[model samples]
Target: MSSLAYGSFCATCCNLIPPETEPLACSTCAKPCCWKCAREPAESVSLFNAPAVICVACDAAMDLRGGGKMVPKPPMEQGLQRCRMHPERFLNLFCLTCQVQICCDCFVVQQDHKRHTIDSIEEVYRQKLLETVEKFREIPKRLKLVDWEAVRQVEENLKIIQEMETRILGDIRQLFQQRTAIMLNKTAEKKAVLQKTKDFVDRTEMQHRQTLESIQGLNTNDFLRLQAALNERCESILKDVGQLQVEPVRWDDIDCDLLPSCKLQPISLNLPNGDAAKEKHVQIQLIDDCGIVWTTTFFIGGQSLALEMKPNRQLDEFHFKAIVEMSHSSQIKVSGKSFSFKGFLAKNELISLPKLNSGGYLTDTGDLVMRLGIRPENILEESDLLKALLVQQRKLNSQLKVENATLKDQNFILRGDMLRVSSESQQNKETLETQVVALTRRLKMFQHNSYVHNQTLQVRPQTPISPVSQPEDDKEKLSSDMQMLRTKLDEMKTSMKAMNPFAIGSFEIYRWSKDSKFYSPQVASHVGVTIYIIVQPNFACEKSSDVNAYVCWAKGPKLRCQIFIEVVNEFEDECVREDRVFDFSKGTSFTWKSVISHYNLFRSDGFLSDDHLKIKFGVRPAVE
Candidate 1:
């Protein structure tokens, strides 16, 4: 208050503060300065009373006083260094607003620093250093622990690899043994046949020579009989030898399922910058899920100019049975890029971005962030709801089978009862016929006698009434009752036949696609499952002469399925059919090759109708 200025520069920013802001003066030199340069000097830096509000020269003097806990002098603050604009004054105060050190003249004269805030540079540096040291004190200890963990993981891997190597070598040796056994069997069988043939030839020659010698001393009839016998025996033996032709190669015996595809290694990755909103070039690291300190790099940036994952090591591999999702704003949807790999995804694989469906994906900060969700595909999984449905259906089918068995048992019982009733009716009818015949014969006799009597006595005697009416009535009623019972039994048998189902369910696949190779859409029905027809339509085959079909099923509650795939002609008759009892317990696929000629399947008026192939597929529980 000793001297007042209308306006003054701030020592910090050198900006002019207008008269209304009310600038303050330095405590020592009485130099007019903005209040901003004082840094609200009346308040405490750490909830305590500040000593005083002074200029850079006063702060430097105070630093030289008794201050313990000394620190290294920075070049800018050493030896009372003068400010750039003011040569006489020292630079000890830090402009908090402008982030630079300034002297008293800069605060009193400069217009830009007029409204800036300033604080003691020493206090700010001291507080920041203490916080930094405290935060990083235990980082070294944690890092040492991490190093130990890495060592343990490497050891585990080494042990696993050793076990794997031994097992694999054993498998290879076993394969060689099996092959050797098969070769030995084939060679032994051929040697046996050759030895038998040589013995037969030698015996025949000896016999013929003996017969010739014997024939010279015998009759012509005996010689003729011996030669004829030799001719017939030689012809029959030669025919038997000719029947043993060379065996064709059996390719079906080649077991492709000997080695498993790969061990299941599941990994989940989130891609935040896949879309390349700001830069088209991007790269991401794929960490190994097996704790192998290994990583594959997927780069969209480099000269390769494609999104691909490259593994550094020869043993590195990846699999993509991935469920990819794209997120824009709050909406998330599947990218429709799920794939099924027979094995792990390997080298030179390209990745595609999840397409955005709606509005701009950029956030408030102009980052078009994309999120990717990844999951490996597994064929050994079943839908839980569908599995439950299948179980219910199976129970129902089993119940129906039980009911059918019960009906058959009842039918057999009814057949016995009907036989007994028919036999009784036959007996009754026979008895009635006998009675009627007897009565008629007796009456005829009586009539003859009566005529004789009439000649003698000249009067006709009364004939006793024949007793056949009751027996005849009983026979008619019994026959009517038997017919009614037979009708009822017939009705029951018809109902039982109708209730007995031959199969659990069936589906038909009749499809025609211009791009049949990759056009496999899912077909779902109330059968509580789905079917996907992935086709390989190759009409032109120069090397192999027929067609092949393969079907894969994700695992579920194990079942013994009898599956039949038939190629149906336009007339609804089976052109060809493949029937097999497939054990669906394993999570693997079944294949049928060379089932039908390729030409017959796709040609006009054959199996194809309107350029479409019709297949009737059926599945039933295999008979135990």
Candidate 2:
């Protein structure tokens, strides 16, 4: 910290955990920083308003949405939830177009939900709460009158209903346990009245119990308001039970039938023989088209799956206990949400096994009828898909036509350039050959000169043996080496030009006939000299129809060094190599071409693309 901001700055504001404060680290770098400096721009909805850990540099440089790796996720907000459409933005606004809560970006940035009856999230929440409360008032209003004669007429039905009552009561008891935990903060006076009101209709039918369980998850404010209103009604009417009305018998009446037709059963864990002790930890994954994965997981035997419904991987996860439910006659289901319903039946849910034996839910052949299939709603389909596709097809056709015309014009221009290059290539080829011959002649001449000079020195015995130090041998030997390299370089250039009629530079051509020559992109050698391969059909050297590729230096200073070049085939096996030693020290011998034989890479499926050939090359330093 600078002197100006030292004392005022938080200890968590920088990288490094000082002994003076607790270690708070950035989510991205894992470096310790003060909360004040490292805090993210989004407002914190943490219990204590604790800021999210993210160094300023990472927050600015990170591109989580653009497919960057090691992405640090944003912390989940408490009251204000995030928008599915835009992960960075919060759902503070309502989207009237879809009658759903949406982030500010959804209304302002996304054009689809722009024009509609927009309102604040709080406003929508309150409106929905009131609507729910109005529906809730229906239960108590009807509870005032009971048709006792209708209920008593079906004594047999009453016995069956009473049997189901015990299990239903147990489920309701557990549901209220969760509810009580939520309602503990309310006033004792209101809670006492709520208890008295609950007692009047505590033994409700299964359907009503389901409705109550669903309502138990309402917001705290809405629940409190609902409870307060219920308390008011109970105080007004519970004073005299004798005033309640009793109606006549009507056995067929839907409201009088207090029993659910659907049978409720406990889930049985069926284990294979000799594997009865095995505990299964299963997670069912639901991946959307956008690549987001939602998993509902559970465990069997010794433990229950503790699935945490966290917004992302970074923050603290809100753990929930998973429940297994038989639900229906067929498929077994699992729900990871906090609220456990009477259970939902998985109708027409097919589990993707190769085959299912023709039997009941579980076949005798042990081929269970387990299938997982995508639901229709999960798939994203455009409403006007056909029209959109047709429009896109038309645009693509027009683009192709324009490209074809442009290519034709370019072909004319290229034809002229090709003719000019051909002429230069021929001239250049001849010049290189001439230079090679001249170099070879000079090398021979230098040998003759050296021999003649030695003979002259021998004949002149009077001539001193050079002041007792070194001879002029080193310089003469170096000159011969220089000429030798130049000769080899010229020879190599001639050979390359002989293999191609289209000049040394790059040129694209289309041919229905098979091609015999290919050039790889120039790659740098370990010595920094650019190296490239010139491939030609080998009919004699390797007795193969594939190829004889030669690696050669390209457009660089000729340095004296021996390099080991290994070439591999399509399967990446070392097919050939040029590891021969170059006697540059002898100043008499050297090699330029590093040739190897391999499979036909000119095939379209191999390295040769339709109009472009892509060959990956690895660079190795020249070893002296």
Candidate 3:
């Protein structure tokens, strides 16, 4: 009999085994075996592509599936445990008082736990198992809820940061635009003044060049003929040159920086151990640009929390106070520089911190952070000061414009006056030259006559010498005439000096308005007095109506004088005059009660033309 006829079998049993038996060859024992004597390989070794079957003796060396692998059982599932102190005995009882498992032998023998309460271990395990299952059932739902809330909070914080960044950028752009506009306006004003001065200088320069060319080329005979006209033109040019003088521009006039000195910045501080949420007392101090110190104290706790701020020094321009409500309230008042707000904070409602111009921020850790914002008071005051200066400068510029216009008018008048003086002087000079020529001819004739008379007296004794004595008398009269001419020339120079253009007083023309019941700010003036005229159509007087005029001597020599006020209508060639004697020692103002009646002064009578009245005043010594 062959080994194959016997089939696979257990060597020890020596009984015929089933042909389906999985046989394993033991590498260590060098023997063939069946599944009953062999085991599966561990998972670590079975992963590789190797023989599936493994014998028990070669289990550590070979790879197999679902064999030789041990599955650990939880200790709680174990039927019972031996006591720590009494290892030989099984712990069948649980001591409630000592909180330990005990063997029956130890519970009976140990003095410490002899009187403790005890229960069966199976009963205690049943109760603890139910509690653990219930706790495990709630874990998944609670974890999902926590995860959702964390993600939502993260998204909300990100959105807030984006909004703040966008808003701050927009504010910065707007601020820059405003500053740019201010600078542009200032530059435009400065340019206008400079342009006006340039135009005047150009015109004057052209006139001067023309005058110089006219004087440069001259013919002796032509010059003598046009001497009076030439002198008048030169005088007029000199008067214009004097009036065209303008002051140079100064640095102080246009010195203004429109940009803000300080910038807005974010500040933050962290409190230690959530102390801000508890009853914590915090005092914070802040200093401002004006060197003012502000202190704020926080009393946080319970249902009520108070926040108080006080300044080390009191301020007149700005007053500040703030109140924070942790609990629900209808309204709360918070003080600020320009405006005040009343509102409530619901739960954890977010609020943008107030921006203070000269104020500061108080932090939880008693640290004060000063946020530099636009100083409202300083800005307002500086704006006001600049506006005032601008207004004054504008007023001065307008006055300068008015004065320049007046000077131009005076220059024209002076030109006319100088032309008249030049004509007169030229006439005088020509007349003097003619007189000198005549006197030279007369003296030459007298010398010849005297010589003839002396020769006749010497040659013929009979001839009379009376003519010679007569010539001596005529010579004395010529000397007296020369003395008178010198005296007249001296008087003319004194008169020219007295006729100063600046010394002449001025007057202004004003129109009365019945609708507004106010004087027009647009005042018309002539050579330094204010002429307040009222057309009183409704005036009650013995006469039906009259023109009332008040004379205010604003600037002039203080002297007792009689002012002759005249209302002249040049087109109509009509005139009305009144004389008022005023003692300037008392006052420089005088009212001409009724200079003229409405009937006599109205346009119908040709006294007022084109709704215009010309007022003229002449000052003279009261004695005269």
Best-performing candidate as measured by lDDT: 3
- Candidate 2 vs candidate 3: the lDDT winner is 3
Counted clashes in each candidate structure = 16, 12, 9
Model 3: CA > 4 A from native = 1-79, 106-143, 216-624
The alpha-carbon lDDT assigned to residue 201 of candidate 1 equals: 70
Ranking of predictions according to lDDT:
3, 1, 2
Give the per-residue lDDT of model 3 (tens digit) for 23-135. Answer: 43333433334554334434555676654544344444533344533323324325666668877556756889988887656666678777789775656777788899888
How many angstroms is residue 548 displaced in model 3 relative to the true structure, after the best TM-score fit?
83
Off by over 4 Å in 2: 1-270, 273-297, 302-325, 330-515, 521-535, 538-624
Better of 2 and 3 by TM-score: 3
Q: Could you report the Cα RMSD, in angstroms, for every candidate shown?
A: 39.7, 41.2, 51.3
Better of 1 and 2 by TM-score: 1
TM-scores for every candidate against the unseen true structure: 0.26, 0.21, 0.27
